[model samples]
Target chain A: MVRHFMAALQKHKMCYALILPTFFLVFLFRYYPAFSGVYHSFFEWDGALLEEWVGFSNYIEAFQDAKLWRSFLVVIVFISANIVKMIPAIIVALLIFHLKSEKHQYLYRVLFVVPMIIPQIVYMLLWKFFYEPNIGLLNQLLIGLGIVEPDLPPMWLADPEWVIPSLIFMGFPWVGVVSVLIFLAGLQSIPNSVYEAADLDGCGILKRCVTIEVPLIMSQIRLSLVLMIIATLKGFERILIMCNEFGGPNGAANVPGLYMFRMAFMEGRVGYACALGMLLFGVILVLTLLNDKYVRVEK
Target chain B: MSAAPKWKNVQQELAKHAGILFVLFFAFFPLYIMLQASLKDNAQFGNNIWLPMAPYHWANWLTGWLAIKDFIANTVIVCVFGVLLTLAFSITTAYVFARYKFPGSNVLFYMLLAVMMMVNVASLVPLFTLLRDLGMLNSLISLILLSIANGQVMCVYVMKNFIEDIPKDLFDATSIDGATDLQVVRSVVIPMSGSIISTLAILRFIATWNDFVMPMLIMRDEQMYTLGVGLMSLNSGYDTQWGPLMAAYCIASIPLVIIFIFTMRLFVKGLSSGAVKG
Candidate 1:
């Protein structure tokens, strides 16, 4: 086997040459930094200088860190919220799929995708604007409706009690275009014969959806669930933009990713940040593995 | 029975439309308000909180254009160069992997696949340090290089599947005609894989254009800021200008909106295909 591999390598040297740049860049940028994160987690590096072997001290510190624990709790809430948030996309996709008219289905799909053209940063900023206490749309609406006094509008992002909720509420309706499209694809792939059989069985629309459509799209849902979990776990940039580095009042909305960023960049505790990263990575890995094991998609 | 069932179907269709329309309202409300508020001054916005006011503040767009034009230019430069380089390299790598039975090919392909699972947030500090050590901080070149590296994985994955589907006879015929590997790729693969290539390019372009975190970390000077960070700075000032800010948001989104206009079908196709496979 070794001799055969060597002969193949010698024969297709050009293939190796062709892939060299990609391999080199991926190693340098991706694999190198990934390994460095693990290596640096055991040190007392301050990002620029002051590197010393710390031997799991950083991880030890993380184990007892109250703020880190708080951030994890916040992330748990977020992951839960995101799971709920994903339902709207699935619902919207189902509605569009069951639409009687093909042209209207296409139109709605196009309209659904229109909002996605806005850059994510722009969308976040727009939400930030909405959450602005003074002269903001949400406050203005409340004041107009006489729900709250103009003098005492809720300080959405600034108030610790409201901050996490506000962050979750930022992307209201949560019908993400990509998620909708994914679900729609899954729904579209369902054979017409299944629908015919369901109809023959006197299945109502909702009943048919519950019994036939969603079950058929379990794989897509599982895939999106895993992706959403990973995204929520890794996402700090949103909170960083909306709530600032400290993550709202008293770090009420701080998740682990934002906390890691604050530690690494703001405090220059690079090694500790790497340790936190390792912990986050471990959680993500375990959850992913567990999901893969548990979330069996019946064909 | 037919009339009763038909009426019920109409009602159900109406219900579906109502539900879809209801969701779309919330989904589109922010964008609608952005467009409306972009046309109003602060006083006007204060007066008419929900609706578009007449005597539109068109000058706010001018203010926005002036503020973010440079950021737009920087982003375009980064995106264009990054997408092209990513495509060039990814095509070559994907082509070789798809066509050749080289040693360790499975391992190498899996190595790239493994990266899809690695959380980028974990590598933030180290990647920043790597950039700093390389003296690429505050440089657009760094942004381009990062885009290329990050974009290569998905592009390669998608393109490899795409290229593998192309008939082997085309490649064989080209190679038999004394065409070099590069020539074959240019003539056979490039021509055959245009739609997939464009789809990948659009995806990469959107990703690169929207990326702000790395740019925020690497770039110190305001002049080096991409649209993401630049838009943040624009909104972060002490006195917020609602009109000009919304206009700026519109400005930032126009490029993507324009791209979507032309490539809407291709984008949807790419997305659904990616969803099914990925």
Candidate 2:
């Protein structure tokens, strides 16, 4: 048995050699932090030393924290708004999919996707400029179009009421290139015979879409839905940049991710931040399970 | 009946074009504004913010480029090194998992896949301390190291899937010629997996180029900053500096825009594959 094991190990030595770098790095950087994050959450560590054992105090505080819960509400609204924006994306995809010529379809796709090449931070900053109260193009356009008086120009990122809406519309007409392309691919994968059969039944475009197209692309819809959820649940980069570190006015735009970031680096509350991180990890894991169990289970 | 349907088809086509045009405007308007702002002086930015004003301040690009040039070079170094490291680790790890029937392979592969789903924010505090202990804080290498480690899971998964599709006969043929496992991988697997590698490379390049969070945390010095970090400094609210800010934005986005124009096909394929397959 010992000789057999030695021969097996010697035969696969090259495979072991090949896997070493990734194994060492991932263990050092990824798995190590993941385990240590939980461990650190139990102590009042300042990144330099474990000051004391806090036990469950951090998690307890998180449970009772009104600010955290409020941020959670803001995050939920943000996520739902993104999901709602997917409708326009799907419609655009369907329209482009039904274009008369392949040439036009391809041209439109290139145009739509071109924006994605720009780093997303640039888009956030541009919107920040647009939200500028004094010289913003958005306010100028609104006044020019008589949507609002000059005196009543809405605050874009300042006032709490407008902050969330401004964040949602920052990427207005959010027909994401990836989502549209995925939807179009799903539409194309539907065999022509199914569409012809629907044509024989005197189905109009809208009716065919409602009954056949939507159902046929349910898988794709589910995929995008899950993606949007994961993205929004974890997303804070745009918010962090737009809100200028502190999650905008009065923490109105705070999500858990940014909240944790500020807690750790800004506030020196590393243990508390780890607790928040653990909570986020738990929520994401739960949602992922739910998505797998319910969202993708049907049909 | 034919005449009526033809008219209806014409109307439908017109409507489709209109809708597409509307979306195109929405997509391009911000970019148009960015370009216009990049060209104009701050004096013109106040009253004529909606459109480009007279006597374009083309010197803004020169000023902005000079300010952010070091950071841009730093970013290039980070991205190039990060992608190379990620590719090396992903290809080797994936090849082993795909071809070798080693003990515990299935468990290890699944563990790596699980890492992809974890909220990276959860690991931020510990990762910071980890780097600090390793004496890598506030350095470009810190960002590169984290990015490589962070990206390996997805890269491995993608490459492993591609490797698994290679015909077994090729591997067998290489082995029959007295090739070592490394030799077979080099001659057969690496050569054949060019398409997936390019797809992964471009994706990684775009991602690293746009990364903000890691750079923000890991690098403290102005010269050490990446484009995103540098852009944040330009907008640090001390001075709006709209002309220079917009100019810097344009300069920062140029490489990505050029890459997108050249490799739109591979990009589209990589993007859709990630979504549909996920």
Fnat: each model in turn: 0.81, 0.72
Candidates in order, TM-scores: namely: 0.97, 0.96
lDDT of 1 by residue, B134-156 (tens): 99999999999999999889889
Clashing pairs in 1: none
Instruction: Sum up the clashes in candidate 2.
Output: 0
- Candidate 1: misplaced stretches above 4 Å? A1-7, A296-299, B275-278
| Winning model by TM-score | 1
lDDT of 2 at B24: 83
lDDT of each: 0.90, 0.85
What TM-score describes the B chain of model 2? Answer: 0.92
Ten-residue region with minimum lDDT total, candidate 1 chain A: A290-299
Q: lDDT, candidate 2, residue B75?
A: 84
- Model no. 2, DockQ: 0.72
Location of the lowest summed lDDT over 10 successive residues in candidate 1 chain B: B269-278
Tell me which residue pairs clash in candidate 2. Answer: none
Docking quality (DockQ) of candidate 1 = 0.78
